[model samples]
Target: MKLQKGWKLLSSAALAVVLALTGCSQTAAPTQPGTEATTGQTPQDDGGQADMTAMLRLNLKTEPPSLDPPKGFDTTSNEVLNATMEGLARLDKDHKPQPAMAEKWTVSEDGKTYTFTLRDSKWSNGDPVTAQDFEFAFKRILDPNNAFPSAFLAYYIAGAEEYNTGKGNADAVLVKAFDDKTLEVKLNAPAGFFTHILTQPTFFPVNKKVVESNSKWAENASSIVTNGPFKMEDWVHDQSIKIVKNDGYWDKDSVKLAGINWFMVNDENTQYQMYKTGQLDKVSSVPNDMKKQLIDSGEAKVDSDASIYYYRMNTKMPPFNNVNIRKAFALAIDRQSLIDNVVQGKQTRALAHVPYGFPEPAGGDFREKGGDYLKDNDIEQAKELLKKGMEEEGWTTLPLVTMTYNTSDGHKAIAQVLQEMYKKNLGIEIKLESKEWKVFLSDQRARNLQFSRSTIPADYGDPINYLELYVTDHPGNRINYSNKEYDALVEKIRNTADETERFKLMHDAEKIFMDDMPLVPIYFATKIFMDQPNVNGIVRHPVGTTDYKWAEVRKK
Candidate 1:
């Protein structure tokens, strides 16, 4: 998934109006402690009982591949990075951009330039945070040599994509620090959602001194220097990670919790056991069979996530190189059955690349206007398409294909269903393979997989975010799918300021994309979990993962 949060407001002027009218009621949440926790800060024995209120214990779905924000693209690493890093702006409960290191910022009338005024803040090591740090970070993200997976997010800035793609020079990219306290940015075009882009961890500044001295600075707890509300205290690789409140934070006085302990447990059943045994305060994944039971017992929680799970076919590879072949696989799957039998929750069946929920600007929803492009299961039609595609290739029998996915119980189940579906419907046999999340991503990027499962949550609440992924050279376009018409439409949306017109172009583009069927859209995701009632103040974003910066463990 493109694991970063994004917001879609009309424009910079409208954003200011909304913020001023809303009265900042979303001020930081006050941290509080529960009477006891499953695990947390080292207990100073009060006779025999350990005081748990001062600590929070949560389970991570997977061990983080890397703590370096730019390189970390999975939800597991993103969740950890969000708590331990501070960016120019942070998202409040409402997904609106809130002040963080940058006390306030303003955009020019032309909407091409942004000026940010910094507040007094320091790193965990007590060194003053400066505007220069941000300048360095933003430029580094656009540096081709860095090979940042999320470099596309910063492309809105002037010359960023050009610089990152080696078409322009670093100095030509218009991000600069005018002084110790002021940072200025010039964009190639007007960007209404740019502020929310800064809330992503990829935009967070790193301590220049610390990162320069140690190549693996972020990988070790002792060497990391962050400016967020919490700082890493210890890390037991693949076992647990411990964090303590940062005393040097600008708003330290407002923070209440002493520490948070995150345990690494990939199995949902194990996490459920830990929560039931009172060794964890929050569990992210609940066992599929136990989902209903946990919710009935008032232990499980569910929230609609702005995400989609899909299967990507390497359009550059044989057999799949034919568009008809792609359409056959996409049309063969019974998405409703997949959701009902495999992915039970509030997950919506995805018939289009962009999920439902984003506004259409004038009225209604963007999805309401576009409607469904992909159809439900049609086995006969799928068979005809596959047969036609095979005939075009002048082959009676094709090589066996393999579908790949990350290691997980739910993923395994979905793969099996698809494997059977294709065999029964199209008379084709495809094998299944699973790898750890990190390995799977690397293999997918290299286009080593013939067919594979891929997912993307909106980095921001816009149709363009999802639509842009299919552009000819987009970093996330791992399937090697490309179309001139699709690329033109994406560019049109980015440059057009009128929402209604942009929506029409996007809707048209989506139709063209579905017609080609480079990827098979499955079901949209709904985050389901179980947690103690005391886990409070976790700000949920519309995109990516939730924010734990203001989290508290208040006694219920």
Candidate 2:
């Protein structure tokens, strides 16, 4: 969904005011362990377990695809790999931009250039992480042959587009190493949210020597290097991956946990069972049946995430090419009912393109700003649109369509709800297909699967992070949706330095998308999990990395 030009300006101004009031310098650093108090005792000492070492076990749905920071973007991989790699910037409890490996930075007045002063950090292999490492990592990911799905993060960098297109030398890009500790980047245009973008792993510096020396680097557990709070110790693909605290980490003294064991369990039933048996620390996307059990046991804790689960129609296909049909499909489903019944009221219904609390912009109601385009449950209107679409296109029978989802019970239940809704409300038949999570992800990226389930995590704390996914030519635009007007607005927001003007443009662009119904809004995710009571300092950030850095485990 696009934001209106006027709203974009107002939103930007609002953000600026909020940032100023909050005192941007007070932003917390990414997860760091508890440090000693000025009183000469560490925080962990209060519990009389100053030397205690705890092992936290996690149950994951799938193994990470890769440990290489530059190549890992998928949620499964990101959750695990993020603990091992340090980015130039980190997302704090509020998902605000903060320092990480880079101690501080300066942005030019034109907003097209950023110079960062790096902290003296060493890789797990004892090699110094220099500014050149970042330059090399950035250029390599932009290589067209690499087919990095996240190349768009660097598109703002000067010469990045040419480098990614194979039209210019990779070294010609804006990133440069002034020395071992200083790095500079030149952007093609002003990008207001560029600092937040740097928090992504794609921009994280890597040890060039380590990656080049190992031919199978990042492919397996042993071939990777760690620069963050933890180091991967063992990885049995599709089974479990283990990590231990990194003593070599710069702030090792603050790290309290000794180890973490991540188990890969695809079945929700098995995961729930593990948690019940006290073998797992946390499990997300709990099943309907298990929710009551966890709640009764006082183990259920629900956290609302700033993510949207939606179904994208392949606009490039024949039947879906018509916008009316797309709107009809959108209007047919009852989003509120879906949230209440299918999701068991665990999630909130999405009305606007931007999910609430994202970037937590001040003084603007996104729902009101969405205008009248937001689709609500109206079976009669949907049928009318569908009838007109079929008549205009010379079609009488509904097309045979397949709705795909992951092999989890929750997804299976959701797909069934959609299938029943489409058939009963619109007389449209939709076959349900479920595949393994990895296969489903692959199919989505290739655009080979139609009408599939997808979720977008907030990259930064901004609405634009989610909005940009729908931009024309975006790698994540799996539905092949392209609107020239929307594309133009996105470009304008990126280049426009005026904060007020940028937000207005984005808000207007969002209205156009909500009106088009290129995607069927499902519900905002509600993550339910249970953690030990001793897990303190584990603040839940709605966006970005979900890890424990500032947290310390104290004995009860």
Candidate 3:
């Protein structure tokens, strides 16, 4: 799912936890079946006490490599981490920023600084959460030795660049704990979406004491302490992980479910069978063949997932460095046909690098505004470009390039289709490689493949997340694509607060990238999940992990 954009507030729950300085009194009513039951419940008058504790079974393909939010790439781990840890702010159902660990914040008139006031909260270990934790986490991520993928999240923070470069002390970085409860942030420039960035799990606080106590702080489940609604009850690598509600949480009343049991099962058919037998509470990434059966039986729910599928070319490689080669490859593909035949109309054909409904200019669509840059398929043009590219590289024929994809049936099918299309339409020889998800990620990060399929889920409901990957010197620029002009436009967009001017600059930058075809636009994927009728209150976010904080299930 994509990240949420705007501010969204919360609603009160039926049960409340009485919190005092020393401890809390556990007194809540028992929950019903087919519902998100409570953990700590009071005895009822009928006959026997009801079981307040409920377990949610989730189907996952793989276990997260690390629970450390800064070091992992698995979305499953992100989902669990989001529940167990909180940031200064969080996105609500409306995709707007809402209070989480920080009760409120203020942006300076110049928009270069933000100050946040923390709420009186405690970690699962009962240690008080302070602003120092945030400072420590931010500095740790910025450390070059750590080499966290999420280090970019703090790049915009004031003085982060200097700190990251080892040119300045950690204390000089933009983040500072004004006192035990208050925190202040400084930015290099006016960042309009800075608060939205705070909602991401990367910005969550990490206890200094906890990290020091266990050098492998996030390596084992026992080493970490939760500051959000849930805590890791049990975690077995590559097997299963269980999360139980943190009864000591500051906002414990809103968390209804007692716990969630996440199972790691890669086989799609096995997961489907488990769902049918009521062993799985929720299942996503459904295959195309079963869509009809599930829909006909009224068991499947479809939503437009905020995931944009695309293929990135390793610009550091030989032919890919040629713009004509990249453009020819982009134009040769029949996106609509792939969407209809390969994905079975489950996805939307992507017109621009950034998909539609991503908040671009109002007067015209991105493609229309793009002019010649949005050129559609032309077999003759693709053939001409390929001929020129091969001749420029002093070759009679194109090299046998490899395209790597994740080891899913759907991904394999798409890869085969792409291979055939390029060979037939553009006379380009291509090879297909499929690997496990984890292996594929590692290989991609290491730039081991010539061309790789990737998807970007919006971090804060902005187009910049997709565009920034190609910026000069960006660590996530795994393909090593760089353009000075493109970087200038990106910087301009970031500095400009005027929506109209910013969009114009953004569109211009997108046009430049499309012209070069650093990444081929594929399609926006649609999320298909299976949920029983009793399931309710689960809101799917467009950008980040789906929010289940306020969700409640009720039996008919």
Best by TM-score: 1
lDDT of 2 by residue, 1-556 (tens): 1112222111335323222221111111111111111211112325545224776778768866666665677888888767777888877765577888889999998878899998887888788888988888888879888888888778889989788877897878989999998999999878767888887777777788987787578877777787888887988988988888887877677677887788888877788788778787556656665554464465666665667788888887756778888889888877655544445535666655576553224555343344345455677899999998888889888677789888877777777767767877788888889988877877888888767788887776567777788888687888888998988888777777666666677788888787777888776665566665555545455666676665565665
Tens digit per residue, CA lDDT, model 3, 200-284: 8888889889887787878767777879888878888888888888888788888877777889888777888898888886777
> In lDDT terms, how accurate is model 3?
0.71
Tell how far residue 146 is off in model 1, in angstroms.
Answer: 0.9
Predictions ranked by TM-score, top down? 1, 2, 3
Model 3 regions lying over 4 Å from their true place: 1-51, 292-298, 360-372
Tens-place lDDT per residue, model 1, 339-402, is 5434656466677788765777787667666777766676677888888998999879966788
* Per-model TM-score on C-alpha atoms: 0.88, 0.87, 0.87
- In Å, residue 281's CA in model 3 sits off its true spot by 1.2
Better of 2 and 3 by TM-score: 2
Q: Give me the overall lDDT of model 2.
A: 0.71
After superposition, the stretches of candidate 2 with alpha carbons farther than 4 Å from their true spots are 1-52, 292-298, 359-362, 365-368
What are the Cα lDDT values of the candidates? 0.76, 0.71, 0.71
Best by lDDT: 1
The lDDT, on a scale of 0 to 1, for candidate 1 is: 0.76
